[model samples]
Target: MAIEPLAIGVCSWSLQVKNVAELKVFLDRLGIDVVQIACGDPHHAAWDEGDAMPAAARAAGFRMSGAMLGFPGEDYTTPQTIERTGGFGDPATRAERTERFKWALSRTKELGLADLMLHAGFIPAVGAPERKAFLDTLAQVSDLALRAGVTVAFETGQESSTLLRRTLDDLKCPNLKINFDPANMLLYDNDDPIQAIELLAPDIRSVHVKDANRPSTKGVWGEEVPLGRGQTDTRRFIQTLKKAGYRGPLCIEREAGTQSERFHDIEYGVHFLRECLAG
Candidate 1:
């Protein structure tokens, strides 16, 4: 049997770089060409106004496996806070966020990319009136992506895989998918990310390579540790994805630690994942 070659990458935001040129320097040292970028950061000049950043990143030999969108007022301090003010959840901010989502979709299309990931806030329970509104909001943005020929991938772990899967099934939107993040599972204290793979495999468009420990107490945030140093079983996780027939980039995402430390972790992650893939 022929083993699949590893396609490791890093999220641009994880590197804390200002632009694609800086990102290229690090990616070259890491020996990779793919990156998952937060497409429209207001502070980042490259993504300030137009398609310039994506174009330049490509010229510098980087291929975007995915793009990310983040809404203003997303508070991760507490679950309640985020539920009250995260993603497109708040009615007061829905209109503005909706417009942002549309614009982000346009950029995703212009970058010639397919997978766009974002937080959709905590999903309400099935049959809840609020669920309808959430689905309706998602449909509107998904329609824009469909027209733009882009796949809108929701990053996993904010909600249970079951809820997300049910939502996608009900929506039945072809352009909707999932970017599985196992660390998020532990961070959110949701279902096991390994089992999540079994459940959400069909919809997994991409995956994030990170690690975190489960929250020790309810209503508290979990701790994020370096890749393979937390709760995730790195080897088994990659095996699960491979078993599920997912053959996409496993992007490194280190949102904690100092800049140099984070870079070291991501560099180690690339080699670690490569070993897992080979094993």
Candidate 2:
């Protein structure tokens, strides 16, 4: 079968603006067609206001693919947690992660979304024991997701592609997929953004279109750049995704900047990606 090119979209925190109508109007002006909502506790949640979500998207004539579900143990600074345990092998940590996973699962359903993405906890491959533990946790989470009837994805980073592939192989769950964020791999200094396409292509369900500096800084996070202007080869990346048969949304995430800057960057990114897909 022939592969299809990706559809473009934007992941916005702009909905947090006091004037959501204005924001939607702005997005429409930029021609953004999709928005990935950020899910979390009601107070800090991205689209907590009951009427904010559908109203804004409706006004703009945009579709919402899903929300980025916030999971517990997200705080890596904590002393003892799934994140500290390296994402899913410790029994106690897995229990905690399970609770967080359940919360995300329930929240996504409540939002009437069929798909969501999250950090599957990072298990650094420091040794044999750590590797085994990480695999165990991956299996457990995959099982949890199977019961939820929703697609759950692990945002790339925190591990090498080989290790991630191995982890997925061990679990063998159909629902578990990759939310391929090229900048993440580059930011972590783990792999080249373009190379990751070959390693993770088959498992990708969604993508985060952004850019970053090269991984020459050694343990430091890469700087986030606007689309088509960073270490990620946005054009080739999209072409590779198409070759891999990934047809999911290309969600543009702009993590920095003021409302004006963010809106501009995201709009620029959406257009950049649209051109990439077309080419």
Candidate 3:
């Protein structure tokens, strides 16, 4: 079978829209029909229609590349705050987060998607006391995804690619893969995005086309900028993805601006990616 060319899409939450209707309007304006939709979870991007969102999204006509899920208490206010709350990182929240993951898996199936993307949180170092529990939680979620026939893509950046690669190796779950975001590597002041992609190439199931500059201080968050405007070197990022054999959709995610600014930036990103892909 022939491989489909990569499609350029946007994250639904990036548009900051409230419902499927609003999302459609923006998608039309952006001139793109592809999206990686939020699951309408209270924390990430809640829909005005609530429970009716799945059916509405399924009927919305846009091509959904995947679904995104964010936990309720995830705090992006600071690096430390998220380290304490993001993903399945907190041992205290593992049970509840696992249940949330179950719900997200169901939503992925309902939306006719095979991939669900989320941050697995900051990983515990290999020899740390919490390492075993963290890996076990990841395995539990991965097993759930396996049974559901959905691929769970943990977004990169919370930890170094080496640690993530090690964790994946330990779990050995075929359904668990990566949703590579080059900008995140810089934002979290983790690994070099270019090198990280090379290391995690085989497991990259999706890509987020974003850009950012490293933080000035060690513990501070980096600055997120429009595509091709920061340190991500987006043109080279696309080239690297191509060289790494990644053929998934490139979903533009701009979370740093007002809704109007975000829309404009994403629109610009569409053109930026098209130019890079063509080159």
Candidate 4:
């Protein structure tokens, strides 16, 4: 079997540098050919301004890869967190989140980015009205995303694979997709990342090439380890992606460590993914 060359990108959040020019230099030094800019500055709103991505992107020979939509909202796992973030339980707060998501959708289009990776609210507990509200709001936001011609993908973390699959099914929008993050499942103890990939293969639109150590001690989230150093079997994961016909960019993200460490992880992950795809 032969694997065609695929673009390898790292999430800019890992670089921990706010300036796009500095980020380009850092990624260039790490030999990263592509990058996913995850700008979280509320004031910049680069996605909305169409100026968040500096001109250096072209000069540096890197692509705008994608945008990881980050906003202050419910973390997608616990309903209480949703309430804390002014979602689900609060009607007034829910409206605010909706407007924010709309801004993100518009921002994504303004930036000429193709996808907006985010957490689609939370999965409420059984018999909870919050669950209904979350689904209802999701449908509305999804409609906006569809009209914008940009994909709004839910990151795979905080919820079970089944929950995410069901939510995606219910959204019923062509632009709705999944940004599978294997390490998140490990960190949250949601499910086996590999198995999740198998079951949700058809909807996997993007992959986060980060790794994690499964929880060994009690009450601890899985540790974020360097690519191939954690419990994630990235080679098998890539094989699964190939088998499932996922042709999207493998966006590498390092959620922990210093600037130098994150760059190292990106380097390791990009090379490992390429070799795995080739094999």
Best by lDDT: 3
For model 4, the stretches where C-alpha displacement exceeds 4 angstroms are: 1-5, 42-60, 73-92, 125-128, 217-219
Number of the top candidate by TM-score? 3
Candidates in descending TM-score order: 3, 1, 4, 2
Q: Sorted by lDDT, highest first, which candidate order results? A: 3, 1, 4, 2
lDDT of every predicted structure (CA atoms): 0.82, 0.69, 0.91, 0.70
Q: Report, for all candidates in order, the number of backbone clashes.
A: 0, 0, 0, 0
Worst 10 residues of 4 by lDDT: 41-50
Alpha-carbon lDDT of model 1: 0.82
Q: Give the root-mean-square deviation of each candidate in angstroms.
A: 2.8, 4.2, 1.6, 4.1
Poorest 10 consecutive residues by lDDT, candidate 2:
73-82
lDDT of 1 by residue, 123-148 (tens): 88898888888888889878988887
Q: Give candidate 2 regions above 4 Å deviation.
A: 1-5, 14-26, 41-45, 50-61, 72-93
CA shift of 24, model 3, Å: 0.8
Candidate 2: tens digits of C-alpha lDDT, residues 202-273 = 898888888887645565566778988887888998888888788888888877688788888887887787
lDDT of candidate 4?
Answer: 0.70
**Candidate 2 to truth, TM:** 0.83
Per-residue lDDT over 1-279 for candidate 4, one digit per residue giving the tens place of the 0 to 100 score: 111235677787777776666776887787766776664544222433245453444455567656766556444343345335533334656677667777766656655576888766456654676677777777777777778787777878767899878777766777778889999888877788888887788888777888998777644577889888888888888787777777877888887787787777777777787788679
